[model samples]
Target: MKKYIPLLFGDTRSIVGVGLRACPKRATTIGSCPYVRMRSLKYSIWVLIMGLMTFFTTPASAALDIEITRGVVRSIPIAIVPFDVNNPNNPNDIARIISNDLNHSGQFQVMPQSRLPQQPHDADAVSADLWKTLGLDDLVIGSATLTDNGQTKADMTLLDLFHSNQSTPTVLMRQSYTVANSQTRALAHHISDIIYEKLTGEKGVFSTRLAYVTVEPLPNNPRHKRYSLMISDVDGHNAKPLLTSTQPIMSPDWSPDGRSVAYVSFETKLPQIFTSDVATGQRRLISSFAGINGAPSFSPDSRSLAVALSMGRTNPNIYIIDLGSGRLTQLTDDAAINTEPSWAPDGQSLLFTSDRGGAPQIYSIDLAGRQVHRVTYLGAYNASAMYLPGSSTKISLLHRDDRGFNIAIYDLQSGTMQTLTQGGYIESPSPAPNGRMIVYSTNVGGRRMLGMVSSNGQVNIRLPEVSGDAQAPAWSPY
Candidate 1:
C-alpha cells in the first residue's frame, strides 16, 4: 500500500509526496469540499491590464482533511447575536462587525442569527438548547448603555454555547468599554481570539486589515488611468482610497504597529519606494535608487524595511533599510531577479522569489547572510511567497499546477508542497492575523476580486462588491 502524508503550505495544494501513499483516498474529496466558510483578503501582481486573470484556489495543502484522517481543520463556527442595544448610537455596531470578522477568517463559519432557528434577544431568554439547535458552537452577546454625559459603555460576554446551561454559564470572556471608542473595532477581534483559542487551539486575527490596489479604468478618456492604494475592513465593507495616481503602485506592506504602509509608487514619473502613515497620510521617500526601487517590506519591529533595489546594479537584490539612520544593509547578492521580499515572524530570515533556479521559486535567506535555502521547487513559476504567523512549522506561496496561479504552502520539516487554492490567477497571498486562512485576489468571471481560503486551503469564498480587476492584497497584523 502507498503511504502518504499531505503537507499544508502557502497555496491550496502542491503535492510533494515521493510516491506517497497513493495520494490518500480522501485527499481529492477534501480538495473539492462544499463546506461554507469565509475570510477577507487580497491579491498583488505586476501592473498588467490586457490579460485579465482569475484566481484558482487549489485542492488540498490548506483545506481541512475530514473524510479520512482528522488532519485537523483550523477554524471554528461562531455565532454573535445582535447586542440588546436599548439605544443605537454608533454607526457601525460592535457585535455585527465582530461576527463579520470571525467569519472572514475562513476558519469559522459564522451562523447568522436568522439561521439559529430561535434565539432570545436578551440574556434572560437565551438558552443552550436554542443555540445548539442552530449548529452554532460558540456565541457572543453584548449590550450598550449611555450615560448622561453622552458616553456609552458596551458590556459583552462570550458564551460557550456547547457547554453552557440555560442560566448562561460563566463568561468565557468579557470586556467593558465606552461606545464608539477608537478601540471598539478591536473588541470583535479580541472576541475572535477567545473563540479561536477555545475551538482551534489557535489565536484570532479579527483585528487585521485588508490592503488592496484598485485600477479604476477611465471609460471615456483612454489615456487616464486611476490606480489607487485602498484599504478595507477584512469584510470588504469599509473601503477607503488612500493614494491615487496616474501611474502604477506595487507591493503595499503593513508596518508592525499598523500605523504606516511602505510601497513602490510611480507617481513621480519614476518608480520609487515611499512610506506613508495610514492615519495622517504623511508620505516619505525611502529609496529613489537610480535603478529599480520597488517591493518594500517593513520588518516586524517597524524600524527597518526589506526592499528590492538595483542599487549595486547587479540584479534586483534585497536590502534592509533602516528608517532612522538611513542605513542600507544588503541581504542577497545573487544576480537572479530577487523581488517580493517577506520578513519572517521572528525577523531572522526573509522570503523572496528568485529565478536563480531557472524558474522563479521561493527562497529564504537568513539575516546574517549565512544560510540560503529554497522553499519552493515543484513549480516552474513561484514568484510571491508569504509567511503564515500562526506557527513557524509552515510557509505559504503562490504556485501554478495546471490551474493558473494559486496559493500553496510548504512544510519546512517534511519538505512537502501542497496546493491551497482551486482556480484562477491568485496573487499576494497573505495569512490572516491568526494564520488559519489566507486572503488574495482572483478574477470573478474575468473581473479581479478579493477572496479567502482556509489555511489548509479547503473552504473558499469571495468578497462582496469587490469587482472589476483588483490586486495586491495585504493582511494587517492584529
Candidate 2:
C-alpha cells in the first residue's frame, strides 16, 4: 500500500509529496545515489505545481481580459446613496435599482454603496464637499415612505457636484411619485430615465420592456423541450411569461405604442403570424395563408404589418397586411426569396432579405412605386436588417464572412460596413428605442443566450444567466 499527500490552495487541488524511496546495491557505478533521485523528485513536484497553476488561473485571467475588453473606458463617475426607508424590510430598493440601471448603460460609473461616506435621502443633507473630495461628479439621493393607502411615496433629488463655489449641491432635477408596492420598480426606472436624460443629451430607455423567447428541457424527459414567450424589464427583472407551448415561437416584434407584439407561432404544425396584447394576453391570428406566413413587423404608425407570405407559391415575398380592413397588398413580386421585412423610420419603404442577387442580401423597396434596389453589397451574405432608431441612413444586420455570422452596421451614405461582434453565430439584432444599444442572440458554449452591444461598438454585455436558453429579443418603444 502507498500513502499520498494532498495539497489545497483555496479551492484548487493538487497532489504533492515524494513517493517511497528505494536504493539498489552499488553493483552499477553510483547506483545508490539517493541524493540525485531526491533532486529529480523535487523537480517533478515543481512541474506538477506549475501545471496546477495553469489549470486554475487561466479561467480567471480570461475573465479579466473579457471584462477589460468589454468595459466602458470613459464612463462618467456618479453615486447613488441608499434611500432612507420607513420600513427596514421594505421590498423595494429604489436607489439600488436606479444605480444598476445607470451602471448597465455603460455611460455612467456608479460608486459602490460601501464606499459612500454618507447616506443622504434629501437635497439638504447631501455634502457637496465630501462627494467632490471622493471624485464624484454627481449624486442621487431619495427617500421612500409607506403611505396609509398601502402605497409607497418616493422623492428623489439629482445633485450636480461640479460647482465648487456652491455651498450646497446644485439641484439638477427633483421628482416625486406615489405608486403601489408592485409598481415601485417601474417608478425607479422612470427616475433613472430622468437622471440619464439630464446628464446625456439623449432620451433614456430604462423604462422600456423586452420581449424574448426562452427554451428549457422538460422535467422528466431530457429529449423533450418546452418553449416560452416571456416579457421582462429592460434590466432582466420581473420576467412574466405570456405564452408557453411545446411548439416553437419566434420573431417577436413590438408595436410602435408598445401595447402589442407580433410573432410567429407553430402551434398547428404550420407557421402562422399572430398578434397578442401584452397586458391582457389576448391573441388574434394575423396571417395564416396557404403557404409560408412569417416575419410580422409592425409599421411605424401601427396600422399594418409587413410580413412574408408564400401565397401557395414556391418562394416567400414581402406583403403588407392592413390590420384594420384585413386587406393584403404584395410589396415585392419577384421570383427571389424575400423575407424579414423591416420598415423605415418614415414607413414609406422597407429593408428585406432577398436571394435574387445569387446570395442572401438586404434590399430596399419603396412601397409606392414598388422599386427595388440593393442596399447591402459589401458582404456575400447579409440578412435580418433593421434600421437603427433615429437614423434612417444606418442599419444593423447579420453579416457573414470568414469569421462566421456576426452583427454588423452598415452606413448607407458611406457605403461601408463595420462589424460589431467577433462572430459567434450572432443573430436577431434589435436596436433599443433610444438607439444606444443593440440586443441579439449568440451561441455560448453550444447554448443560445441573449447579448447586447452598444451601437458604437464600445460596450458589450451578456444577459444574466438563467435556467433556460433565451433568444429573439425585441426592444419596446418609449
Q: Residue 282 lDDT in model 1?
A: 88
The number of clashing residue pairs in each candidate reads 49, 0
Worst 10-residue lDDT window for candidate 1 reads 42-51
Determine the C-alpha RMSD for candidate 2 after optimal superposition of all C-alphas. Answer: 17.0
- Compared with the true structure, all predictions reach lDDT values of 0.67, 0.79
Instruction: State the local distance difference test value for candidate 2.
Output: 0.79
Question: How high a TM-score does candidate 2 get?
Answer: 0.83
Cα lDDT tens digits, model 1, 109-202, are 4554444444444556667776555445467777765567766577776666544545464456666767445555566566666666555556
Write the residue-wise lDDT of candidate 2 on 362-431 in tens digits.
9999998999999988878999999999998999999998899988899999999988888458899999
Off by over 4 Å in 2: 1-69, 86-92
Q: Model 1, stretches more than 4 Å misplaced?
A: 1-78, 84-93, 133-136, 145-152, 164-170, 181-201, 219-222, 312-314
